[model samples]
Target: MTYKGDVTVGGPADVHELTDLMISKVAVGPMDNNAYLLRCRATGEQLLIDAANDAATLLTLIGDDGIGAVLTTHRHGDHWQALAEVVAATGARTYAGREDAEGIPVATDAALDDGDTVRVGQVELTARHLVGHTPGSIALVYDDPHGHPHVFTGDCLFPGGVGNTFDDATAFARLIDDVETKIFGALPDETWVYPGHGKDTTLGAERPHLAEWRARGW
Candidate 1:
């Protein structure tokens, strides 16, 4: 339950006012897991990612925020435990992978697959499956208003570490490979990565660490 750093507040305006999207990060509960509020400036369309264990905090921050949907990265309790409450508060549809759909208490409004695109106002998010930490882990990829792509990695990839794996080691390795080749390699160097835990990092900063992590057999 350590608070690693201050909760970062950022958006399209924080970078450039001309950008049409805004993103805000709220660190909730003792775990300090980051929950992102992605808002489309043009239409006031919003998406909440990973409510974590603290429903009240998330609800308070998202009060009448006009959330359009809730996107979950995996089935971990610390990541999605507040999903039901958030959905009830916002009356927003929930999206998750079909494989982990049953684990979630509420009915999933949409079952996303790898490469599927989800549109929120002017934002288009491409779902990339990365099943190492859980059977249905995925990352959301989209082009920011600045035209630079960004990835919401959840627990799949952190600034200096990868997601915890209760599954087989070999399977986790494969997941790491998918993240490197498909996610990190696919995006531009300037692409921002918002992870479930820790500070935000760029693809350029994390790319060199991939080789070191792979060498360590993570």
Candidate 2:
């Protein structure tokens, strides 16, 4: 289950065996949003992130393993297009950032704030509230003792730059600062970053260019 260095991003729908966790990702809907199924090997308990779109496809991916919970990274419509359908079908508990919880049509069983933990079997993911993308947009941190940590940055931090701030300077600043302090500064360079869309990147690859991203004002 141990992996060396960084993980290589796969195509549209694929599963990556990362340490003790198995991550299955599928790009769905019109936006090409990524829906990830994270399964803990020890207890076989699982959690689904985004549930972005394509209910039929998401159900097929869920199969019989049964998702213990579904975590919505933010309240963005594109990110939760299939949320109701998926939750209805799976009967899984719903969790989201407290501030943005009202934006979603579905009721969240639990409101996850920064420092709150979501348990998937034995794995405990720490919630990091990264503002700007959405007031309560959060990234779940899985810090493995033996390997680099894995952070699911939902539309807040991306490969080359921070998520779009919709031309708001203050929001952009907040996102970059949070990423630098909460993500980059806290985790090692080998930490794997899985964003809301597109390919993944390691901290090491994006670390040196933080200044560049800041200077360019993206």
Candidate 3:
């Protein structure tokens, strides 16, 4: 079915567009987790990232296109409250980082490793394992043919700093290093970041504050 109206934050919001792909975001559940739906404009195939709480809302977002796959960024309960329901409803394949797959309520059909690529129709999203928030926490990177990259950082990197490390100093360092090299170091300033919660931010806006995050040691 044709998706009516525009996408919004609490509803469905059009995040951005690649050559043949359109990214949409919807915030759901008590924690206000952001669930992202990436649709291939050419084929109508769709992929969802972080199918958090409120299965009804997610199902509505899934709509007639259905889903080709569901990629769980981490095993956090808040991130996958609707995982089993969505997978059961659509029969879509499931994928998650190898280290964290087992914790998920549903079995992962494929294991995601750093540098792995997941495809939705013709669009390809590269998985980057950014361990810290969770041992298998990951961020998916989508590179637009004509623009800077866009990343779905599950619970990893956010606008202010990396996701909470649960007071683990070692995990905090690991997250900081990966964000610096794999993210801030590799991509241009224009890269758009859609986090697990709250507003969207660009790498350019958060780049200068890296030092502050490091010094504060969060």
Candidate 4:
């Protein structure tokens, strides 16, 4: 498969091949959340990003390889519905953004800060904390050496606009600012974005609309 990042709940996953890592994207739950299983090519170690929902499907995806960590993008209930069960089954360490750790029901083994590094075997993902979607929402950035950078942005970002802010101007501002500075400004246009819900997009594809997203204050 081409790894288009298009998936439907209960459908088979779309796998992306890279030199050192393999990305398996599967959509789960009623909300249609996307859960990614990142497997390190060398060590065969894997790390699951967002155990969003459907433990049975997620477990079956894990197979016997297992995972080292389950990092929640935010404290939102829909994003971590299967965390407890997935963690229990794999005995994987639980990680969440430092500020959102208290909000998550599972005991967080590691409370990540802005630039914390989470490893999946030899592969590493840098945590970028983008506020607004939730006080402690974090996006995982994977800079594949052989390829372009990839970001697992939770609800903070999407294809057309940023996540819903409930019309809160302050949160909207913070989110947009962080997104521009931490995401858009810092990352190149080619950075591939894998969001929490819906289809995927690239920073390049979304850069032109930053002003519009800010102007609308969404």
Candidate 5:
């Protein structure tokens, strides 16, 4: 099936196949958190992003091919509810933004900073640290070898607007600034956005409403 990028808890995952990598996106937990399982076609090396919930489901998705790393996009509890369970089961190394790493209960094997490279077999993902949604909210950027850029934006950039800053103007400002500079400014319009929750969107779909999102003060 074609990759629609829409998924529901308990529903089947959507798989997007690229030239050298495959992304399997599943929605899990009550919060409907999205977990992405990426596999490199060349070597079968796998990286699981956000073991949000349902270790059984995630582990089933893993099957016999064990995972190498589990990258939590942020420090949010909902996003890592199954982190310990999954890590314990697979012994996969844990990764998180450096500042948010201390907040997670599990020990981070890697404390990533902005522009860090995360590898899954032959594929490489660039970590773009966008602040304010949390002290450390990193979005992984995969410059697809065959197509446009694909970004795994945690809770930072969503379909309609940016992530919640809890009404703190300072935090909101920081988040918006980082998003604008690192995401909207740096990436192209066709960039595919895989957010932490809800459905997917593209940069072009949300670019014209930047000022509106700012004025609404979300």
Candidate 6:
């Protein structure tokens, strides 16, 4: 059960230490939703992002390690259905956008807007509202000890595409703008982009495609 390198689940544990961040991905269910367990090597503090669809598997991944916080990108069941169980098991505070907070079991602890920081041991994640897939979808950004900025882009921005738009077309369009002009455009080119459901890409890699995305009116 111990993952060693860059894991893609249902496969061997491809573990690797990225500076102070020990990363592992647990793909739960048929959707292949990736739930990330990020442990800060400096303090051994754990942060769980996107609980996916299987609570039992998530509990096993978390184990006895201290989970300081659990963050959900949106209200989609595949992304956060196991949140309540994780919270109960670890007592880890949950964070989500205020608009979708009601969907979560614990709503009081939910975050309301962009720029709110949630601390998990030594790691402090700044929440950025990247609404599109949902009215309250968000992304988390933080700097690793090596000073490499990492963004856990929930479902907003993927490797080469964007999240599905079922909410409001106008709002979804605006959300894409915010991601381009704010999230992706605002971060340093070297920032590592870990998305909710795809291969990892960087801010620099996604920058060039912004114009093409805009041309398609997405």
lDDT per residue (tens digit) for residues 52-102 in model 2: 888888888888877989999999999999999999988999999999999
The C-alpha local distance difference test score for the whole of candidate 6 amounts to: 0.76
**Candidate 6 lDDT, 1-218, residue by residue in tens:** 43332445464323436667776677777677778887877889988888876788887777787688888888877787787778888898787888778776655376658888877666677888876778888888887667768888888888776777764678668877879866777788888877787567788888888888766765
- On lDDT, the candidate that comes out on top is 5
The TM-score of predicted model 2 comes to 0.93
Clashes per candidate, residues 3 or more apart or on different chains? 0, 0, 4, 0, 0, 5
Better model by lDDT: candidate 1 vs candidate 5: 5
Worst 10 residues of 4 by lDDT: 1-10
TM-score computed on alpha carbons, candidate 6: 0.87
For each candidate, what is the lDDT?
0.78, 0.86, 0.88, 0.93, 0.95, 0.76
What is the C-alpha lDDT profile of model 4 across 7-29, one tens digit per residue? 99999999989899999899998
TM-score of 1: 0.88
Models ranked on lDDT = 5, 4, 3, 2, 1, 6
TM-score of each: 0.88, 0.93, 0.94, 0.99, 0.99, 0.87
Q: Which ten-residue region of model 2 has the weakest summed lDDT?
A: 3-12
Off by over 4 Å in 4: none
Candidate 5 weakest ten by summed lDDT: 209-218
Q: Which segments of model 2 are wrong by more than 4 Å? A: 1-12
- Clashing pairs in model 3, backbone N/Cα/C closer than 3 A: 7-12, 7-13, 8-12, 8-13
How far off is residue 62 in model 2, in Å?
A: 0.9
| Residue 52 local lDDT, model 4 | 92
